[model samples]
Target: MRMVQKPSSVVLASLKPSTYTNRTPRAGTLPAHRLAGVSKPDAPYSSRRAPRCGLVGRTFSPFTIVLLVILGGVVATAAQEDERATVEPTLARRAATLILARCAVCHTTDLIVQQRLPEDRWTATVEKMVHWGADLTKDEAAVLLQYLTARYHPGAPDHLPSIENELAMTEPLRGQTTATDGPLTGLAARGAGLYAHNCQACHGEGAVGGVGPKLARNTILKNDGVFWETVLHGRGPMPAWGSVLSHQDIADIHAWLATR
Candidate 1:
């Protein structure tokens, strides 16, 4: 039987740790720049990761807060304005009650407000209303006359009032107004203003015939009944002033025209 022979001493020594020190490695080592490209920390840096796709919009919260505040203010103001308009008072109901109960039996509030009389004239007017069957006491009569004259004649109220009450009050008691009872007095003084308004355009400035015949110069005035008839009938384009004018106002105007 033959046995295997041992390896050479040189070959056995080549397997030792440092025997192949001169040999070149088969793979090349990478530079620091190439290794750094792939390397990362445990977490990404805020500056380097495409800014984390910033979908967390930072301005959204402040804008939403301001918008809500503006809407709230508008709604509150509208509610206040609605409350005021819905509750405002009307005058016709309040003043009409007082006028109808206190003064309507003999004279209307219309008759009282229309006459621009002074306080003294209104005192006389209250006395006349009393004579004409107005059921007013001395105190009620004074307050009413004061209110009438103060409301109509010139001057603001002594104290500012916080309310408005309408009255259709105009003219003195229609049945008893005369030259003295009305605001102005006398025929010539009264008729000039009246004729300027009513008759001057048609009958000339002072009743000289124009569109209508001369009222003063005509033969009608010589007969009182005829004059009265002509005035009431309104013979031409002239209107019937007899019904509209107070009796004394008619007589004063007639007396004034006679001189013209």
Candidate 2:
């Protein structure tokens, strides 16, 4: 207790001034990296670890760059496919054929479809056609009215479902009526059915006219069998009705049309 111990230089640093004048070493000094806060490895160690850290700091990760490139290519291909897959929205040309031939003759399709009345109003319209000597069978009348009311009426979209939607509702109706139903004797009646399906567009109820010449004027009366054949086979923009309808169906239709 009586003898006092002298402090070592390492411990006596506190006795030195807090701020001292620069005393630069002549040969070399302790590492400047350590003074700035970095610590060098103790002994022999691989130097590659520091370089790897620098690479990560200096650039985008290679994996991230590759992912961005792949995503960009996928987005480009999707855009191209969308451009090529444009869809159309309108009544199919085939659907218009009958309406154009049969209904447009008396009044414009614009007028006909625009009327947009109830079921009773539609029945009255068909009945009026009957009063005018239009030869439509009961079934033909129903089909014609149904077709018109479905496509043209304001209430149609609600009451009458489209064929596509009907896949869940009812079996799709077929165009193939029994051939035995065909008869030259009943040709006029059969033709009425065909007319509702095919001729209503331009011919109207009695083959009047909107876009084409009227049948009531006997334009059809003067046509020869060959002429009929040519028209049926589509000489031009008229389209080949022969291909769309069966032979017996064609015969019955021809017979009914002749009566009209």
Candidate 3:
């Protein structure tokens, strides 16, 4: 075979720049790098291998650790709030429905929420509303009272400490004559049984003293309004019974307490 001769340097220099530029890269081959008019050999590219098991040589960064800890604490606190805010029972739910439909007509939900009245006061307030044309049936009224007294009673455990301390500090002096000593008859005489059923446990058998202070000769009885308001709205440790007792029942009890 005849050998081909290499081109002389002079002939090679005479070639146009396009001659080299027109050359195509071979299949599966990368182009060479050029810097400062010098050609550089193409280097073989080796990709980084993935770590064994994806974390054999890895370590958690400080920021990542802190982020994880914060997420955990937030999850824990949210769980606690969920547990504390469980739904009301069936009777309570029915009462809420009635209250929303009837009470919301003339009053705001917040107004009802803000009041921590007793069963007695709740009863009185409801009776007054009925008298004012609230149009609630007797059964509906009873359910509403159950819900109100159970949920917003002044004697709620949350208020117990503060109320107890206040009442204890404000006890009246011994031997002070009360307006309850005034002549009271008829309705009061009939109220004796009612008082025994409703008031005796906390107020004592003769209203002398028990969990509550002595109702006998107490200053609260001097004014009818004050006495009724105290029983309806509650004072210090005493819970309001306005929801539980009828206006007539409260009046009767008031009369009975006067006799006591």
TM-score winner: 3
List the global CA lDDT of all models.
Answer: 0.44, 0.44, 0.51
lDDT of 1: 0.44
For residues 183-206, could you state the per-residue lDDT of candidate 1 as single tens digits? 433387777776665556567777
On the 0 to 100 scale, the lDDT of residue 237 in model 3 is 50
Which segments of candidate 2 are over 4 A away from where they belong? Answer: 1-186, 217-219
Worst lDDT run of 10 residues, candidate 3, spans: 1-10
Per-model clash counts, in order, read 6, 17, 15
Candidate 1 to truth, TM:
0.29
Worst 10 residues of 1 by lDDT: 1-10
Taking the tens digit of each residue's C-alpha lDDT, what string does model 2 give over 183-229? Answer: 43435676678766665665567776545556664655456465356
Task: Report the C-alpha displacement of residue 47, candidate 2, in angstroms.
Answer: 51
Best by lDDT: 3
* Pairs clashing within candidate 1: 109-169, 110-170, 111-171, 114-170, 114-171, 115-171
lDDT of 3 by residue, 88-176 (tens): 33444345545544564455355666665656788898899889866467777766665565445442222222322322333333332
